[model samples]
Target: MNLVLFDLDNTLLAGDSDYEWGQFLIAKGAVDGPHYEAKNKAFYEDYKTGRLDIYAFLAFALHPLATHTRAQLDAWHAEYMETHVKPMITQTARDLVNKRLDDADLVAIITATNSFVTAPIAREFGIPYLIATDPEEIDGRFTGEVAGTPCFREGKVARLERFLEAHGTHLDRLGSSWFYSDSHNDLPLLEKVQHPIAVDPDTVLHAHALAKNWPVISLRGDQHA
Candidate 1:
């Protein structure tokens, strides 16, 4: 069976979920607005530039989860889904994913954002498989540290390999595979796939996609790249 993978942030959703989550917290007075905004923007810019320090970013990103009770976090996340996340979901993105599902392909979301920020977003997309950074939890409380390799850059490929291997298959075993992403950081898995599609790609990925003759598409636009 063919495998189809999507990058969660700008690829599948119009906005970055992780960054938005932080901003949502700041808006709710859960965090200091100026402080979190600056950090969030800086880290996000670092991410787009391919120089992100994943662990450092995570410690900041997951800190709020550790500070709040699970119940409070859940309540805020529900509001986050409605206020920040839901509007980012576009019709074209949904159609693309649903078509893949209807075609019986193996589909999943692979993201660098911690699962705490991305799990509900994945579920909302109706995609069953998700490979994201895991936040360490003990006794129902977050530790603000990663449980394993963060699914960023090369880590994404490693995690997907493990996931496929566990299913009794590997990347090469799939009849064909497709990875759709927006960031250059996804090049590891994007290059590995038989079909590497760039969706609303950033500068580096756009140039790379052009140089490699790969199809580039944008769900946000009326035209296909």
Candidate 2:
């Protein structure tokens, strides 16, 4: 048995998941602000670059939702799925997921995206496990805080270790573990995998991928392997 971990944002989807999520919150009446886009973008950039830990990222991402309850955030997530994510599913990524499902591998999504938003995408792709940062709640209301370690950089490897421990799986025991990502920020986790494939990578990651002699793949037209 093996594990196939995938990154959520540009690796699976076409663009920035957090930005889309913030837009979703604004559209759903969950957050009201003219600065939502700029603020969310800045926070997301920092989080992706590993400057923000899991808790800080969630605190900033869902800070707007702090005015509401967890139930309200859940409902807003539903709207987010329908409004922002339902249509952007990439054929190549979907096909890759379907192949993994067919092979019965333990497919997991490891993303820095908030659990509320990433959960829907995981469900859409029929993934069994999701590792993401959770928003802290007190008496059902968001505290504008995050719970547990953030799933970014080395944090992703830590999250994977915990998940495997709970499931009686080990990193070496996976036999042939693989990870797919597009960000240089994911270098820590990518390096840990036996197979690290850089898919449609950005400038910084692409350069590192080349230097490391890692196999780079693309999901765009006429691209594969």
Candidate 3:
């Protein structure tokens, strides 16, 4: 059996969902527009350069979840799906996912974005498995705390191992394994796979992909591979 992992935010979608979610909230007046956008954009820059402190960013990102009721959050997220996320999805991305679903033994979206934000996106891609950061919850409400390791950078490697362990398998047990990502931040997990594909990658990953002779491809028309 083989494994195929796709990075959700920028790889499968034309844009970054986490950053877009923050923008979405700002547009909806859920957050102080200028203040939130400034911090969100700064964090995104850090992420692109592989300098992000996941904990600090999580604290910022998840706090709004704690302040809102589950019902309200769900309603907003439902609207987010229709307004922000759905438009980000493209036919090429969907086709790539469909191809993997038919060809791979296990296919999952591995993203640093919290499960709350990424779960429905995974379902929209028809991917049955997702490996993402988990936000703490109690009594059907968010606690604005991380449940375990944030699935970012090296944490993605650890999370994938745990996921494989839960299935009584290991990376070595797979006939082949592949990971597709657009960020340099994902280098750790990208390096773990037998095949590391840079999909419309950032400057850093683009250089690394070229140096390592890794195959680079683009699912979105606007991106250069």
Candidate 4:
């Protein structure tokens, strides 16, 4: 059976959910205004160029979960989905995902963003499987620590392997595998797939895809292929 994997941020949504989530928190006063927004934007820039330090960024991004209760976080996230994320869910993304879901044996969204921030977004796309970075929990409260690998860069491959194992399958078992992503940070997993689609790629990933003869597509109205 064929396997299909999607990247959540720029690949599916018109904007970056991780960065927007931080801005959402800052606007709600859950995080420091100037300091948090500055670091958030810096981390986003680092991510675009594939120079992000996942550990440092997570420490900053996940801290709010530790300070707030689950209910409070959920309430805020609901608002986030409504106000910020919903508008970014473009028709192109929805159609692509729906088409893939109808064809693929296994469809999954594997993002570097933590599960707490991206789970609802996955649901919005009507995707059932998600492999995202896990935020640590202690006594039913967030610890602001990573559970395992950060699911960034090479960690995405590791996480995907674990997910396949859980389903009594492996990458080799699939007939054809596809991975769509926008960032160079996802190159590790992207290269592993039989079909590597660069969806609205950044500068580095776009050049790399062009050099490697990978199919370049854009769901944001600028179609390369």
Candidate 5:
């Protein structure tokens, strides 16, 4: 089956999941103060502007809970999905995903967001595969460090490569592998796909898409990459 990879966040959701997730933590009492929100918001800007590296940005975002146990983080993630991110999935995107599945496409989510956060979103959508940055754990506690490469920018392509290897699939073998993304940060993956579609593209990606004759579509113009 052909692979249909999708970026999370703005491509799938209307807003930044990371910032909202941090807000969830603060609201749930899992984290304290307004610093979490500030840090996450700033990280979004830095990431979009290509200022912050993926690993460092994630570490900074989660630093407040560095001392929390893995179990605690897991519970928090579960709650965050149910109470925060789960309800934010746009109906248009949901319809799109359903249509792709109906076509028997091999669906997967490739995001820079942490696996702990993206797992539930993927599960809710019934997606069987997800490739995201995994946080390190030791002694049943979070180490505040990434276990592997932070799946951002070109890292998304690297993770997809590993996924293909594990599943005995390759890009060239697919009949019509497609990728949908929003941010300019995902340009690497967007460029690698056989069918690259810019969904809710950012300014940089929008211009490139137009200049290259790439498809630029939005789910009701709600995409703000």
Candidate 6:
């Protein structure tokens, strides 16, 4: 069976989940309004420019989990899924994923966002497998620290390799593989896949996709390259 991988944020959703999560927390007063919002925007800009420091961003992004109980976090996330994330789920994105699910034996959402934030999003897409950055947990509470290599840039390949090894399979074992993403940060995995699709890609990734003669699509509108 073929393998299909989808990037969670801008690729499948019309927006960035990590950035929106921080905005949600700020609106809820879980984080300082000005300070948190400023940093969130800065971090988002860094991500767009391919200059993000995953560890540093995690310290800021995961701080809410450390401050609140798991139950509280869960409740907030439920609201987040309902309010922020659900609206971003366009019919086009759903159709794309459903099509892939029907065609592939294994379908997964691979993202740099922490599991705490993305797990439910994956569920919403009906994707059974998720490869996301893990937040350190002690006694069922987050430490606001990353557990392993943050799944950004080259780290995505490392994490996926480890995941495949645990399943007693490798990239070559799959008859064919497809990876859909928007950011240049996902170039490592996109290049690794046999069918690399750029969905609503940013400027850098869009240019790279054109150079590589990869398929470029936009769920936001009727745009294709």
- Against the true structure, whose lDDT is highest? 3
lDDT of 3 at 82: 89
What is the overall TM-score of model 6 with all chains considered together? 0.96
lDDT per residue, candidate 4, 186-210, as tens digits? Answer: 9999889899999999999999999
- Stretches of candidate 2 off by over 4 Å are 47-55, 220-225
Q: Name the 10 consecutive residues with the lowest summed lDDT in model 2.
A: 216-225
> Which residue ranges in model 1 land beyond 4 Å of their true spot?
221-225
Badly placed stretches (over 4 Å) of model 4 are 222-225
What are the RMSDs of all candidates, in order? Answer: 2.4, 3.0, 2.2, 2.4, 2.8, 2.5
- Look at candidate 1 and give me any clashing residue pairs: none
- Per-candidate TM vs. native? 0.96, 0.88, 0.97, 0.96, 0.90, 0.96
lDDT value, residue 215 of candidate 2:
88
Cα lDDT of candidate 6 equals: 0.91
**Residue-by-residue lDDT tens digits, candidate 3, 23-123:** 98899898889999999999999888778999999999998899989898899999999888988888888889999999999999999999999999999
Better of 4 and 5 by TM-score: 4
**Residue 3 lDDT in model 6?**
87
Ranking by lDDT: 3, 4, 1, 6, 5, 2
Candidate 3 or 1, higher lDDT: 3
- Residue by residue across 125-211, what tens digits does model 5's lDDT show? 878889988877677666778888888998888999889888888777778889898888888888888889999888999998999
- lDDT (tens digit, per residue) of candidate 2 on 69-88: 67777777777777677656
Q: Please, what are the lDDT tens digits per residue for candidate 6 over residues 1-225?
A: 588999989989889999999999999999999999999999999999989988899999888889999999999999999899988888888888899899888899999999999999999989999999999999999998889988888999998989878878899888999999999999989989899999989999999999999999977744321
